[model samples]
Target: MTEPNGTTPSSDDDQIRKILETLLADDEDITARAVARLHPSIKAASSITRSESRSRLLAEYQQRQADYRRWRRRVAKRSGADTATSLADKDVRIAELEATVQLLTASHLAMLRAIGELGGFSKWAKFYEHHREARDRLAGFGAIPTAPVSSMPAEQGGKKIKR
Candidate 1:
């Protein structure tokens, strides 16, 4: 079967993969929904998300990020690079760190939100329960921080205040 562009299904898939790779390389949002919006012709974005291609790409990107984090940590340890040499260097480094933190936080919150949307709190809780060991490993690696929920300062409605 061929797509509307007279390309075979595999070719169409290749096109989609290329677009996805470009989006990832640019550090742009490439959620299935976002991709569908950006390219209206690809109508099966949700199905694509469940496909092996999407999973592979996501895994690859995650591995790259993990490698980057390990490299940065190693460099920091070797050079004690946490201290900036000048005020301008400090400002630039602070901005970069802030952006990284924000990106990681946003990615995590988005995943949590997706889980909630899929099956609410019960599913979210179940997910954590199922992944407890992996989560602990991540925390141990310092990829994620372990903090007590009660220790967080709450706002008026039980929501944690963002610092």
Candidate 2:
């Protein structure tokens, strides 16, 4: 039988036989030494390839972890900044409101002191005359009228009293 390349089976077998015969004819000790050297070289090459691949993988993983940590820190910083900004704005609003309340409280206290300086009845009468709505509102709540006492006595000794 002949192979597709047109070499007879016997001729092909003869070539393989001649090659093996030549290899077998070499000194056994020399062949063994050559094989031993070649084996160690192949093993060293494989080990170096494995070590390079492992080093590349380790470097890639470390870079990825470092990038992730940096990203998390950036996000945390932004959140902290946002919180600080919001707190600052809220503090400003609270300060403005406190100032407004203080002003209003001062005005109300001044009004009360001014009214108290006058005779209570005269103050209430003036307030009723000027602020009819406030007087009506107060009257709706049934507020009691107050009478002021004078320092002068009314009658002294059964005679008419003098001013």
Candidate 3:
């Protein structure tokens, strides 16, 4: 807004600059020390006491702080020990599982060997016969007859396909 004769208003920058300059000029009532230390707690139970009494209180505070640190260290050590025990238990369980797996694998290999000795099951002649029989039962429904096992070339692996 303009003044009566159209003069623009003056800015308040000068006033702000003066205020900042005054504030930046250091004086009393301003110190780097903490305000809490300057004016301590005024509670009746914790009022400012003689230096001797304050020394005792300070020592007690320090002792408590030290005790808390010791407790924390003990807790950390105990947790580490517990973790070590858990790891040992896991190792034992893994060893037991490994033994069980070894036995199971041996048993499986033995069973397969036994089956191999009992005619190896290399040919599906018996299974084909049974499937043909079922298909014969379902005849007239477009069931196509397949060549019998006997029609196949004999002497496959020196074994006869039984009827």
**Which is the leading candidate under TM-score?**
1
Tens-place lDDT per residue, model 2, 55-128, is 34334444655666666676677778786787799999999997886676567545544565553546556756
| TM-score of candidate 1 to 2 decimals | 0.33
Model 1 regions more than 4 Å off: 3-7, 65-163
Q: List the residue pairs that clash in candidate 1.
A: none
Q: Give a tens-digit lDDT track for model 3, residues 41-149.
A: 3222232233354334434444655666666676677778786797799999999997886676567545444544455423433554758775454343323223222
Q: Which lDDT values do the candidates have, in the order given?
A: 0.61, 0.50, 0.44
Candidate 1 residues 1-163, lDDT tens each? 7756566656656666676667666766556665555553666666456768755664565566566666667667654444344445979999999889778766765655554445454654566688998767645545442332222344768776886
User: On a 0 to 100 scale, what is the lDDT of residue 107 in model 1?
Assistant: 77
Worst 10 residues of 1 by lDDT: 144-153
Best first by TM-score, ranked: 1, 3, 2
Answer with 1 or 3, whichever has the higher TM-score.
Answer: 1
The CA lDDT at 89 in model 3 is 95
Task: Please report how far candidate 1 places residue 71 from its true position, in Å.
Answer: 4.6
Instruction: Write down the TM-score of every candidate.
Output: 0.33, 0.27, 0.28
